[model samples]
Target: MRQIRRLLLLISAVWAAAPLWAEGERAGDFDYYVLSLSWSPTWCALEGDARHSPQCDASEDFGWVLHGLWPQDEDGGYPSYCRTPKRDPSRAETAAMADIMGTDGAAWYQWKKHGRCSGLSAGTYLGAARLAYGAVKRPEVFRKLPREVTLPASVVEQAFLKANPKMTPDMITVTCKAGRIQEARICLTRKLELRDCGAGVDRDCTLEDALLEPIR
Candidate 1:
């Protein structure tokens, strides 16, 4: 009984001291942030079964969803899992950001894969992600993609730039998967201001024009 009590006490002490995402040597070692906003329809169609998100339920009028806030280096590289412990966000911890991140699997995977490297606790990282996602004003045309509306990358870029006066062409890049518009990735400084990502990061949407399949 004495040994068991001592072990339980030790476990509690370690958890309290370990801090959420700031434990390891690699924490806080990043350059910039990429706030990726995914079109809910695209995600529902593509990775629906894999992620099993609430957005796939088709109950609400879902538009763009927060994919992740990823930390990146100047060279277009990123670190994952870093030196953080296996700290997962509890239900209360994810409440504020769950609306955009999708309450199910998205939040958990993102925290483990990307947020762990941001040098913040799960709550802090999730709160920051919500802020980053809210910073950009999504264009109406993209809020609900027009039926059978296929457009060029430049057109989409222009719409966003016009919507967000502070956002620039170099700072936001449209991403596509299998010729379908997927996400809009915007580069931001550590302070959450728009910034150019430079030539190191290749824009994922290479096609001249991509199809925007309307959300079903």
Candidate 2:
């Protein structure tokens, strides 16, 4: 009994002294990215019945693009989650295949709309991307996005202004770029500018299809 107790104590000390395995050792490490584009009149001209229609135009604070990948550190090993773009099509799916290809596309679209009206914050976009990639890649690198995102603000501004420059505006584009991982970008176009920090102005509205881009 004494020998057994001594062995047990020795084992406990060794176990306690040993390093604790980190949960994110391979799951938390990851890189993220963002890319943005402006709406072109040619693209915006697309209407109902068109193969791919612009759901929202720059004037209405639209025209944003985002793409991402959870690449591995090893060369030529594309992200294990790359398949996310083709499978489940729903967040509920546990398989990486369904996540990368299916639900991610819808999630991107939702983020675009939500971001436009402030319903979705920048964190929302990053969170969705991370969640999607995590479901598949399980990267170990830190996945938090930078304070500023890398979006094509200039392009959005040019488009919105070309449509109506007389109106004051507040526009911003954010891009999130992480080495190795695919980039993700978002653009926000605002026509109404606050003359005063805490004031509002009259703005007109028209009902149009919530077209951002062709559902692809």
Candidate with maximal TM-score? 1
Per-residue alpha-carbon lDDT of model 2 for 33-116, expressed as tens digits?
Answer: 212222222233433126343233233322222234222222212122221111223343222322332323434443333222
lDDT of 2 at 148: 22
> What lDDT would each prediction earn against the true structure?
0.78, 0.29
Model 1 is weakest, by summed lDDT over 10 consecutive residues, at 19-28
Task: Give lDDT tens digits, candidate 1, residues 1-216.
Answer: 999999999999999987565333486688989988887777777887477666777675667789899888887678787776546699667665668876646788888778888888888888888898888988887655557677776677788889899887789888888787888888988888889985555475776768776755
Give candidate 1's total backbone clashes. Answer: 0
Per-prediction backbone clash count: 0, 35
TM-score of structure candidate 2: 0.23
